[model samples]
Target chain A: MGERTIIPFGPQHPVLPEPLHLDLILEDEKVVGAVPSIGFVHRGLEKLVEKRDFNEMIYVIERICGICSFIHSQGYAQTIEGLMGVEIPARVKYLRTIWGELSRIHSHLLWLGLMADAYGFESLFMHCWRVREKILDIFEETTGGRVIFSVCKVGGLWKDIDNETLKRIVTVLKDVEKETKKMADVFTRDYTVQKRTRGVGVITYQEAIDLGAVGPTLRGSGVVQDMRTLGYAAYGDLVFEPIVEKDGDCYARTIVRVREISQSFDLIYQAINKIPDGEIDVKVKGNPNGEFLTRLEQPRGQVVYYAKGNGTKYLDRFRVRTPTFANIPPLLKMLPGADLADVPVLALSIDPCISCTER
Target chain B: MSYMPKSPWLVHYDASSCNGCDIEVLACLTPLYDVERFGILNIGNPKHADIFVVTGSVNEQNKSVIKNIYDQMPNPKVVVAVGACASSGGVFRECYNVQGGVDNVIPVDVYVPGCAARPEAIIDGVVQALGVLEGKYKNMVKVAK
Candidate 1:
């Protein structure tokens, strides 16, 4: 039934850096469907929670999405410390799990250098952003803002990483894990990156859990799920695990973000060798009167953060569901019939930030 | 070196940002702030650009595709803009379909303030838009004499 045409693709193309738009529906170079249209870069920011309050709304939910800005202020400071119960200590949950696994290894090496500059492989996207500028120089040497790291705070962590800066952030994450394993072996054994991501856009594990896919596109379809092993904060005494990959395509979501950036450098070297020294924050006194619902694992997936405090200091809603808005209906169900030159690497293999899906 | 025109090209335009200054303006053409070693490339058409750059801000569905890609470049072109929500609409400047920065719609020379502007300040705002693209090509060859 090949007789259709509509192309669009983005709120600005060139392998889209953000503002999404999709549309597609072609038939010539194949792709028979894809609607997608997000609010350009919506900054209603949960309507700035009725004018910033629950402690300055964690800098407006960490600017919503500057590459998962410190896990959207650590899931809105762990849902305003689980609605004002506030117990943040154990060195602020090992410094927000070592700055949330170093902002999930700089948002999975900035989505593997924007999916190697969206397939054209411009010098493997400049060696995957020169190993992501040493993870943005370990996030501007422990959060002074290299990308909205207002250092997560709602009951904990404004800044604190001593022990010689956690031994120079484990010697700059072992030289950013040896330059991200030589750029994840040229993106998992290159051959023009497995001929533009093997089996381009497959999605199956029951269509990624009946299309409600989350994180690593539902752990690259094997579905082992991972809101950081659902342990929250210090990942319930560390030792995490979730990098699955059953080849749901786009080369198993780029091998589950290159093995979760070497499992976020062994969970930031077991959170800097069992970090435990005490008080990073915990002085909250009021406001934040209930209703929580948090969730984290960001670097592109599983980010729900609903909060509805109604006990003053501006009590009200602050919703934020962003994993590119639950992976855009599984990225429009992996863009039908595929090949409109694999629609910008299947819309950048579900890493479409779209200002965290219209903040 | 000889009236500098050694590859300026550029044309990145994401009019309603938050892809953190469009991934630091594609991290200034990678290789650890290469800025294509001053030949600056980063192209994707805008009538074969000259140096438009832009990042984000000026919304309402991308302000007429940012003035139709700054009127399809190819002039003594030079824009820049970059970050802090493309200089002004920084934090999505009071939302509701922002209409703030990128000089409220166009005409910016080189703003590049940060909020996501680094990559060595977008290669010093593309080397200050290569000195405003060599003074708008010496005022368009003095209005073609």
Candidate 2:
């Protein structure tokens, strides 16, 4: 029998894009237990709502995490809109959906690249990011920022794309789809990738449900829980189904994200095709006087946003429950008994966004 | 300041950031903006790095980690603080835990300022650090004599 020893995993490691600390209690090469610690990137963003007005608060929320910035802003805007009982125009809904899907595609591709990098596939990582550049270009061209698109607002959206530009976006997405398909084939079939990821970290369906996992982590476990089905934005105007994979392993999570990229593309195409001509935003009047909760299906998982207004410009309380926060308990659950070598990949399988969690 | 090494190794460290800057730093390594063409490699170990490219603001929990990495780097090293948060704590300056920018913990040679500094700006910051590295190396040679 080997003596159990403790090893600190990180606040900084090579593969992790965000800061996270896990104290791994290891018995020889296998991890026996783990204690997770956060707050490294906590910016106290929720507290900022006290100072900034509801309309301006979207910027703060968007910066909660760069990768999930758009969705964060979207969720917050939608929540405040709901609170104020501001009914935005139909065109605004379609634009929001299109942009939301774009953000999802980019986020999923970024995760895919990071996943490849975790297993030491440098060339594959570069190739995945190369395709991601196209998506970023589209963001820069349309919304003016590659990472933080400050286009979402309280009433509706801050900007609109003409049908001609919308057609161009659809064209670019088609090209991105072609490139992504090639990468998907490599990810699903490559021997080395499969060897590293497949069956490496398995969480049963019951365990996922019990742990309250969300997003691809839960969907990967065969649970069809998707917040988009709740019909936020223009989702009700389009056909939608939650993508579910039966296997509860690292490979299943990977497949779920890969498949989602195509799903997002199709959703965007549908949105552009059905989008009608109308004003993008309505004049938002008065302050929100009640509390409302908004749920968004982010790239990683389901994020719940809660906003409490006091009939003033300033929000009384703003709280966010990011997907990574909900997935952390499940991450801890899966870590014990995993090989030390598998810790990085297992942690990444949840697509842990520490900034989002801490913020 | 004649000695500009053929290849400059950079170690990226995140103290407390939203990761907008960190991903942009990573983007510099990709095919589109491959800073590798400029003989820059993103190394993981601080001890082997010629430049310290830091993203994110300094915070109570990470200030020590930031200092540890800075002290570990070899002499003639230059530090580039990328993004507005790294330069002056940006939007998170008011947070309770945020101590300030990277300069609060270590001396900064170049400050690249942007909410999330663009990749081109980060690459330019690294290029600027090369000059600092050259100056520091020359000063070391002069001190030895």
Candidate 3:
């Protein structure tokens, strides 16, 4: 081995949209180990439960990660609703699933764009984001906010999507799926993309499970675990299978996400077709007096939320175990023996959301 | 002041942002918004950047980080604090780890407000930063005499 050297990759880096500082110990061009540090974006949001009432805390939680904002609020509301034994109406569940799926699609597309950019495919990155903009337009039109959507309230959603708008959403999704397919082809078949991603960051199935990997990282290792399968919201009423790939390399992870986008699209279409007309919300009574833990599938992976209520408007304690936190170990496993030049691609493979991980 | 030799070079740093503003900041560089049309290029190095765009509130760990980036930037540099978090710490203002807005660390030339500032507003902030850059340029030239 050549003389060992240290290279710091981020807290600020062009390839990463979020802050994830890693100290890579390298021998010549190959990384031998990595020391990771987070908390740069930690706003101590969990502690804000004491200041904001449980009702308003959904807003705080939604800000955990902008790309996954809707799902954060959805998970928060669902957890609190569980703590209070509040059973939401069927329509509310369906609406939450729809919006949640939209979050997944846009988030996955954003990752795809970032990955393509990491491969130095600028045109692909631009096109991927161009398609994603339509989803953002859908969000702005329906939710009135693009990034930090505060649509989820404790009892139910703030507004109901009209049937006309729902139908239009279906048509819009059809176009999005068509365009996503083109980009998916490039991600899968392109020479440079394959050169950069495939076989680059390999984690075996046993290693992924042992490392506590979640989301695409675990699924890419051929693990068939997805929190959606737990039947939360409309997932119980809907029929779909989790996408899994066996290679557990960067390519497998990318394929898992690409396939999941189409799955989420189909799930949305399925929900719209089966959505029953009913009251959007129900009367919620009394403060929560118990503790509850919930697991939900975020685009990145399964997120765990634990909430404790003390018979008041405010929660006693609130905590989240974001997927990035779980995936970081697996990321560390992949770093050693990697070429320094492939560090960015390896980092992006985990779809690290340091903001959510820290919050 | 009449014409700049080139469009401004921008360096974006996420101080303590939730990434809402950071994503929108990136959205500004993408196809629809395409800040590149105005000749703005997003660069990674602080020393080469003329405009420093920061998102989120200042926190304990990133406070020194924000200052280091600002100090590395050449004189006559412009800092645009994007989103409500960077402007005045917004909702996370009361968080224990957070120290408040970006201005608490570096001088801010523009402040864009939004829970997560919209791309339209972010692009507008960049345009506004350009004007401030030109003004600073003029002041630096005056000092040279």
On DockQ, the leading prediction is 3
Q: What is model 2's DockQ versus the real complex?
A: 0.76
Q: Highest TM-score among the candidates is held by which one? A: 3
Least accurate stretch of 10 residues (summed lDDT) in model 1 chain A? A36-45
Per-model DockQ: 0.23, 0.76, 0.88
Superposition error at A116 for model 1 (Å): 23
User: Between the candidate structures 2 and 3, which one is better when assessed by TM-score?
Assistant: 3
lDDT of 1 by residue, A322-351 (tens): 776777887787788888887888888888
What TM-score does the A-chain of candidate 2 achieve? 0.99
| TM-score of every model versus the real structure | 0.34, 0.98, 0.99
Candidate 2 runs further than 4 Å off: B1-4
- Show how many residue pairs clash in every candidate, following the order shown: 1, 1, 0
Show what share of the native A-B interface contacts model 2 retains. 0.65
Per-residue lDDT for A115-231 in model 3, tens only? 988878999999989999999999999989998878889888998999999999999999989999989999889888898888999999999999999999999999999999999
**Residue A307, candidate 3: alpha-carbon lDDT:** 97
Query: Which candidate, 2 or 3, has the higher DockQ?
Result: 3
CA lDDT, candidate 2, residue B27: 96
Looking at candidate 1, what is the lDDT of residue B135?
84
lDDT of each: 0.80, 0.90, 0.92
